[model samples]
Target: MPLARRSLIEAAAARFGWRRAYGTTTEVDQLLNEQTETAYRDAPDHAALATAKNTDALTVQPGVLDARGRVLGEVLYLEGLLAGARNRRLPQELIARLEDVVDHGHELTVLLADTVRATAAAHTAGH
Candidate 1:
């Protein structure tokens, strides 16, 4: 499923659980907001990698062994790459992304609430 839809489902499920058990809309809304905000805050960082095209700096010597031990010539490698690169940039993006994620989460929570309200109304009308 699409990432956004999956996020919605998870939030909706949590909200439904809270509402069904406690009949508390406020609590359920809070829970849904918290969950969804977390998800958006954690969205993948595609922007940081925009500079990844600089991989041309790598110089791979001919004859590198693959996992099967087969020799492969001329592998394109990334130069000046750090093992903890992602970790380093994550902190930089965290606060900004957290706010973005929170906004998205709020939208998701609102959408979920509307859907639930509509579904319940439909069921009530049918009955």
Candidate 2:
């Protein structure tokens, strides 16, 4: 609603959204780096890095990361926002949607973890 509030939302999106979404900082930074390179690859080194730092949100996806750094899907980013940081009363419909997003997040997280573990094991076994 206000400038400060909007800034706070964007900051939260970067912190809570990206980390929780991808489940790790390394992978998240990898995606961020890739996105930065994709955008400023042709620019001078310092300029590119600065641009990347400035426009990171425009580059990296807010949530989720691909194992091969490709395709992925999005889900809730603020599912736990109110629980952890703030408590705002939301409409019933919005609350239900939040619940659904969280439910889907749980399911997808488990699926992704299992798939990644299996893939790692197979690679270790020389697959």
Q: State each model's CA lDDT, in order.
A: 0.46, 0.56
Q: Which candidate gets the maximum lDDT versus the true structure?
A: 2
- TM-scores of all candidate predictions against the true structure: 0.27, 0.36
Q: Candidate 2: where is the Cα deviation over 4 Å?
A: 1-76, 81-86, 125-127
| Cα RMSD of predicted structure 2 | 14.2
User: After TM-score superposition, what is the CA distance of residue 15 in candidate 2 from its true location, in Å?
Assistant: 16
Each prediction's number of clashing residue pairs = 0, 0
4-99: candidate 2 lDDT, tens digit per residue: 674576688888655334557775686587668778876668656656664533232222235322222344354664243335676666577767
**lDDT of candidate 2 at residue 17, scale 0 to 100:** 59
Instruction: State residue 59's C-alpha deviation in candidate 1, in Å.
Output: 60
Mind giving the per-residue lDDT tens digits that candidate 1 earns over 1-127? 4557756876798887732342577756766887799898987664555345323212111111121122111111111122233446546464455545545645554554555456556556867
